[model samples]
Target: MDGGRDSEIAMGAYQPGYLATRNRAARGQVHGFRVALWQEHLGRDAAAEAAGDLLQPSSLACVRRMNQVAEKHWAMFADDSFRGDLPGHLMAYPVGVGSGGELLNTRDKFPDTNAKVLGTKSNILPPILTT
Candidate 1:
């Protein structure tokens, strides 16, 4: 994994006053693992072979494990049995920083070219004008 991608994942593992966002990250991790398994063990180009391999007992077990972990985390987020005091400070700090970091990282990867096109203009025209 790229250092930048890993850092973004780490930052996303938190949300203000709630751990639900971390659960979302966990789900993404499972998907990543599935993608790796598909690319490596079954080969990305071999769709038929991948399907066959996924039917095997070992593959089934791996799928089951991933599903179980995802279910557990999802339940934590969905459940609202308790109505105790919220962790305001804990929620505010981590969620904001983590979300901001993610936004910065994403923007770094794909910059807004509108600024370059518009130049010093206070109001720029639509993309259609440039095309």
Candidate 2:
């Protein structure tokens, strides 16, 4: 799972097997699921600046793969201000906060990795968001 301060501070709440930093949120990632950093700094250290005004630092954790499925589905429950699709196969909902992926059936899947975003030219809406 890839999440924010909540995931970093209290990962036990999410219970993810392999975790990444969700670069879009915190600008960091796990290397081989071993090491994690909030953000990479060159000559000077900017951990404080990069952290912005967060109350806590970002999280870094790892473990063996937990769930193994033939397919993966991603979903998002983010703040209302967020206005875009998730980085991976995940889709966003105008709500709370969550990251990473979850198991789902094919019929209930959001979208496969190959799914594409629709534009003005396409009249059909993505079924992922439809019930």
Candidate 3:
């Protein structure tokens, strides 16, 4: 939201390609797919290092590394470079999408009958302070 300010802008590159699930295998937001995939690449000793950066956006490292692993049951892969071939500028934001939705168990998980609560009668924030 800081559109304008004569100051240095800092960006953290933690990364973001991990498949999303309601389930958690590690700490907050760590993907199980990423954990196992990384585990295979690293030895007994610094395997944790591979698990560290699963969230880097459009992370080719995650995709490529996952495909290399022998176990395919937990892995889902198709692209060789996994969008690595795309230009760097193109990879910034909104360049891609998500994992395969298991079209079977999926119903309208957010049923329209009950999801209207977000815009319900009183979801208000305290008014912003002014200078």
Pick the lDDT winner.
1
lDDT of 3 by residue, 48-108 (tens): 5435444442468756544433233112222233433221111111112336642232222
Clash totals in order: 2, 0, 5
The C-alpha RMSD in Å for every predicted model, in order, reads 19.5, 15.8, 17.7
Q: How well is each residue in 82-129 modelled by candidate 2, as lDDT tens digits?
A: 456432321222123235554323332223333323212334765333
All candidates' TM-scores?
A: 0.22, 0.16, 0.21
Candidate order by lDDT, decreasing, is 1, 3, 2
Predicted structure 2, TM vs. truth: 0.16
Cα-based lDDT at residue 55, candidate 2: 19
Steric clash pairs (candidate 2) = none
Candidate models: Cα lDDT each: 0.36, 0.27, 0.35
1-131: candidate 1 lDDT, tens digit per residue = 23434222322333344322422322345444544554453334432334444434246765664444444433333345634432111111111125446422212111223334223333576643432
RMSD of 2: 15.8
Model 2 CA deviation exceeding 4 Å by range:
1-33, 36-73, 77-82, 85-107, 112-131
